[model samples]
Target: MLLVDFVLLSIIVGLLRKGSLKKIGEIPIRKLELIFLSLIIRYLPLFLKGSLKEYVVQYILVVSFISYGLLLYSLLSNWHLKPLRIVTLGVLLNFLAIIANGGKMPVSLLAVDFAGLGDFKQDLFNPLYPYHVAMMPKTRFKIFGDIFPLPKPYPNPKVFSLGDVLMGIGVFSLIQEAMLKKKSASDKISRRKLKRNL
Candidate 1:
């Protein structure tokens, strides 16, 4: 995931350096600001501490999803393409999985217990409450269980699926692209000013 993010960032920066998005640079940064804010808010659940944190995180999740959806809608209104579609699908899948699993991806409690997660009430067990009931898609229509993760040697490797990987890549790609475009526009503006002065 990190490697993919780095590669996407590099590509975006390279494109920006080429001044491909110079014209679009003049547009207001409000849209970009929303995206950046959303990114920060989306991850707040993982770091929040204390009893009230869960409620706070849940509220933030709802708001963040709505804001993100709106932001995507606004961005796609002016831009459309195959790459965007692929990224959108990945994001939607990830969101659905999260929502289906109680706003957080469920990990195997047994797996965690075996890994020596001493206290089950800690932040690590935030995914699922009890041993049997997991915030995950179960076999039955109404049941939900942490039926994810393939059989691996590690007891508690972060059990993320293929959808998550794709989503992460898409997110990284989008951010890198935006930053590169902004930087490129700034450089082009500077060059134009220099030419005018000369």
Candidate 2:
């Protein structure tokens, strides 16, 4: 949901600048396949049945977190892009926090209540949702947990983390930068074609 907010904010900013949706498509995310691989690994538990689901889900969660770290590392390894680098660092922080807390992203009960999901239970293996669990007194890396609440002030009420804030900034910067670069490149091409025609 944090990522969804990033996308929506980026789109609004892009529109404000008269940028086209195609500009966002031009963001050069590196090792994109690794991101997909991580998702596939994360969701792989859905295919399991019976008691095997719990054990396999736990194992896959570890593997999925590892895959996520790899994806961030891969993205950082390429382009030397500042925005992507920031996002990679943010993702690394989130990965570390999640792995340290048994591969589940810690959710603050207070934030949950603020989000109008106060009735949220301690269900970690809900088939409808995955990889999220309530933050308890024993949850490690408490600062990295979902402590931020976007309440009624915003249309969408959600809980987010500090790393999520960092990543949101990075996502907006990446999209805005891509839009400028795309427009600049298009202008140069148009200029070249015009000169040739003349």
Candidate 3:
């Protein structure tokens, strides 16, 4: 998903500016473990036997929704940060769509074709292996689902949700601020040391 790519790119940008990886610090979530646990909950079922009936599959997705919700709440609790606030709104929008749709995210076929992901049933699943189904006539909050595309010629062509866009913005802003903050602190320390040496 673009969220993963967005986070990776944010860290890369910070490091490129000579900001130490440590400058990114811990994301200001109260229960950091919950975030990790959420990821595991969302992805652990992919390896399970596909022989699972439809309802069982849906239940697996329900567990994923709950886990992801906890993680989102942890992040939102720190919403005073501009980036976090933007990310929270985007996440809630996505959550609304997922929860309303049998716990599976809806991806528009048009978006998939636009991304050149092909019409293969297997390709229907997002590469993130998120429990997503094709968007139907009655999909709620369809705008929040994977309805946008990064088409061919893009390094990573993919269908993304509106939530993905806002999350990307938040991630970029968070890293930019952290890197600048670290630089300011370093400059202050250096000036102080220089004066003492003088």
Q: Evaluated with TM-score, which candidate comes out highest?
A: 2
Ranking by TM-score: 2, 3, 1
Off by over 4 Å in 2: 46-49, 122-130, 182-198
Kindly list the per-residue Cα lDDT of model 1 for residues 1-198, writing each as its tens digit.
Answer: 332543455466656577344433443434566666656666555566766665665455474466457656644643543345445565555555555544554455554454454454275444322112243236222212233333336433333444545555655555445545544688899999999999
Ranking of all predicted structures according to lDDT, beginning with the best and ending with the worst: 3, 2, 1
User: Cα deviation of 40 in candidate 1 (Å)?
Assistant: 2.6
lDDT of each: 0.49, 0.75, 0.76
* Candidate 3 residue lDDT tens string, 66-105: 8768869777767768787788777787788888877778
RMSD of 3: 4.0
lDDT score, residue 153, model 3?
91
Models 1 onward score TM values of 0.49, 0.83, 0.81
